[model samples]
Target chain A: MAYWLQQILNALQLSSIYALIALGYTMVYGIINLINFAHGDVFMVGSFCCFMAAAFLGLSFLPALLLSMIGSAFLGVAIERLAYKPLRQAPRVSAIITALGVGIFIENFTLSLAPYPKVIPPLLKNITWALGGVTFSSLQLIIILLSIGLMFFLDYIVYRTPVGMAMRAISWDKTYVPLMGVPVDFIISITFALGAGLAGAAGTMYGLAYPVIDPYMGIMVGWKAFIAAVVGGIGNIRGAVIGSFILGTVEIMVVAFFPSTYRDFVAFTLLLLLIIIRPYGILGKPRTQKV
Target chain B: MNMHRDILLEVRDLQVSYGHIKAVKGVSFTVRRGEIVTLIGANGAGKSSILKAISGLIPYTGHILFNNQDLQKIPAHKIVDLGISQVPEGRGIFGNLTVQENLRLAAWQRGDKQEIATDYDRVYTTFPQLKERCHQLGETLSGGEQQMLAVGRALMSRAKLVLLDEPSMGLSPLLVREIFKVIAEINLNGATILLVEQNANMALRLASRAYVLETGSVIMSGGGKLLSDPRVRAAYLGA
Candidate 1:
């Protein structure tokens, strides 16, 4: 029982990171119907932001997190405006190719700057608590709580606020929203900013937990989170979190119960089976009428 | 020239193209304050395109003056702040959003926080059905209810001029009369109207004046008597 509990705790930490990153995919997909293949690299950039703030500027965890979020937000808005905006009216394949290209550019750009993978300096105290033979670290607790908190905050912004209303409105029908006094382009930019900011937060927490990050790291983690988002229902907010947890728990359990090398292989296979069963995903409704 | 009314919106030599196919070619018209002006025509006649231009939804080369201010280079959202609201064709309601959110969206650019509540109340009073389904998702509402919600949005936005595109489309005959009555009520409440409709008979009955558009140009325009004009009857009224 304690062993299961320990794995569950581990799953919570890992899933929270996936959840944060997954939201960026879901949100950008929600508004523009673009996968933003470069999103993984945005997560990569976010970690570098955190790395710079922590290692060079000597900022603590909170400041580093805030700075990383802001940096990623700006980077996200810039990416959307410069690269994605022109392709808004272009073919979907063009945008997808551009996104893949953008990801490659970001990876190469970072690779040229820093060829080696960097280790994150410990910004938080390493404290451990063992409850009934289940051991957990403070870093795990912080990552889990902070990530879930951020997701809820994102939920509030997407559902409760006026800007959030516009965001939802745009997803439903981009054409007529402006007639109701909505600045469609501006709302889209805000969506990108929010999505990227969350990814940045995920990157920062991810670095703190894993302690190592390279330019190429976003690819694998990003693909997994993208799968989580798809499994949860790509455009649905709550779905992404649920999918992330499922993916995280499954990945952790596979490593625990089976060969550690089969972690990703098993995870992908299970998600594939789930997708075949529920094509729209766990919470996603079939898109009967796409605007 | 001998009238007290001022033109609320003036379109001069407006042109809109959807890649070589000129949807609206050199269209010109004027909507004086407090008149229910209907633009009646068949599909592809540029009626909707004119509204799109005035609302800044599409790019155009001609001048559109709203309250003597040129609408050139203005964006769509800004056009709403200029006090013109369009209930677009297909009732452009965000189906996933709640009825309350749909109505609130109309008040997006308004600064009068106090008056906004009054507007909501007025809309609720006008369409009690909307109030009952305020918490429901917009897509769940019946067609008439959705039309009511769309028209109700005009009231919520505090628009001075309302551009209605094909409001009567896909509605039952009974609901059509009901919507037309509500539209008349909306106009009597003081918003100027530029109505575009394929249902010429219904639109003509409700409009104070009318323009006949054919192949992207105003072929003919006149007072209520145009409803019975021999040419209009043969071509449009289908008598």
Candidate 2:
């Protein structure tokens, strides 16, 4: 039972990071039907932002997180406006190719700047607590609480607020929203900013937990978070959170029981099985095309 | 009172084409302030296209002047902010949003916080059924209720000129009468309306002036008495 509890805490820590990044993917996809394949790299840029804030500027946890979020949000908006907006009316394949290209460009650009992996200086003092033989760190608690807080805040922004209403309306039907005088383009940009900001927060937390950061780090993590977004249902907010937790649990358990080498294989197998089982995803509804 | 009424919207040699297919071909018309003017036509006669052009949704060659401002310079959302609201064809309600959300979204561009609150009450009073189902998702509402929500949304935008496209589409006759009554009420309360409809009998009865379109151009333009004209009666009124 103690061993299981420790594993659950590990899962929560990993899942929180996954949830933040997956939300960015799902949100951008929801507002505009683009996958925004470059999202993972945005997460990579976020960690570098955090690295600069913590290692060089000597900022603490909250400031570093905000700086990272602010930086990535701007990057996300720029990516959408420069790369994605022009192709809004283009063929789906063209937009998708552009997205993949943007991801590659972001990765290569970062690679050229930072050739070696850099370790993030500890932003939070190291503290550990053991409860009933289940050991946990203060960083883990912060990660869990902060992620849940941000998710709730995002939920409020999307569901309760007037801006959120416009976002939901835009997501539902792009046509005729402008007639209501809701600036569709502005709302879409806001969506990108919100999503990227969440991913930035995730990057900062992940960097703190892992300590080592590199340009190529976001690739595998990005793919995994995307899988979480898909498994949760690509457009649904609640589904993304649920999907992340499930992915985190599966990955942690696989490593906890079997060899660490089995982690990616098992995690990917789950995604394949999930697709075959739930094609529209766990919470996704199979939409009928209106004639 | 001045004999010459103020023109709220004017279209001059307006042309709309979707790639090679010309939708609205050189249609020119004027809507005076505080009057309901309707465009009646067959299925492909380009009624909706004209509305689309005026709302800045589509690219148009000709000039549209709303309140003496050139419409070509404005974007679609900006057009709405400038006080023209289009209650679109198919009653484009967001199915995921609730009735209240659907209504609230219309008032989004405006900063008149106090007036918006009063307007919500007015809309609720105008359509009590909407007030009753304020929290219900739009898809749950019946066709008639959805139409009501659509019109209510247009009203929420505080538009000076309300362009209604096929407002009576897909509703029962009784419901159509109720919705038309609301439109009439809305116009009487101080809104200039440009309406497009296939249901000519109801539209003609409500319109202060009506234009008949066959292919794209207006074949006849006159007042309510045009309902009795042999051409309008034969083509539209089903007489």
Candidate 2: stretches off by over 4 Å: B1-5
Q: In model 2, what is the error at residue A257, expressed in angstroms?
A: 1.6
lDDT of 2 at A65: 95
Report lDDT (Cα) of residue A96, candidate 2.
Answer: 90
Superposed Cα RMSD, model 1? 1.4
Model 2 CA lDDT for position B92: 92
Error of 2 at A68 (Å): 0.4
Q: What would the per-residue lDDT of candidate 2 be over residues A28-100, giving only the tens digit for each residue? A: 8888888989999999999999999988899999999999999999999999999999999999899999999
lDDT tens readout by residue for model 1, A1-291? 999999999999999999999999999998999999999899999999999999999999999999999999999999999999999999999999999999999999999998999988999998999999999999999998899889889999988988999999988879999999989999999999999999999999998988888999999999999999999999888999999999999999999999999999999999999999999999999867832
For residue B195, give model 2's deviation from the true position in Å. 0.9
lDDT of 1 by residue, B1-239 (tens): 53524888888999999999998889888889999999999999999899998999888898999988999888989989989999998898899999999998889997677888888889899889999999999989898899999999988888999999999999999999999999999899899999999999999999989999999999999988988899989987788
DockQ of each: 0.78, 0.86
Model 2, C-alpha of A243: deviation from truth (Å): 0.5
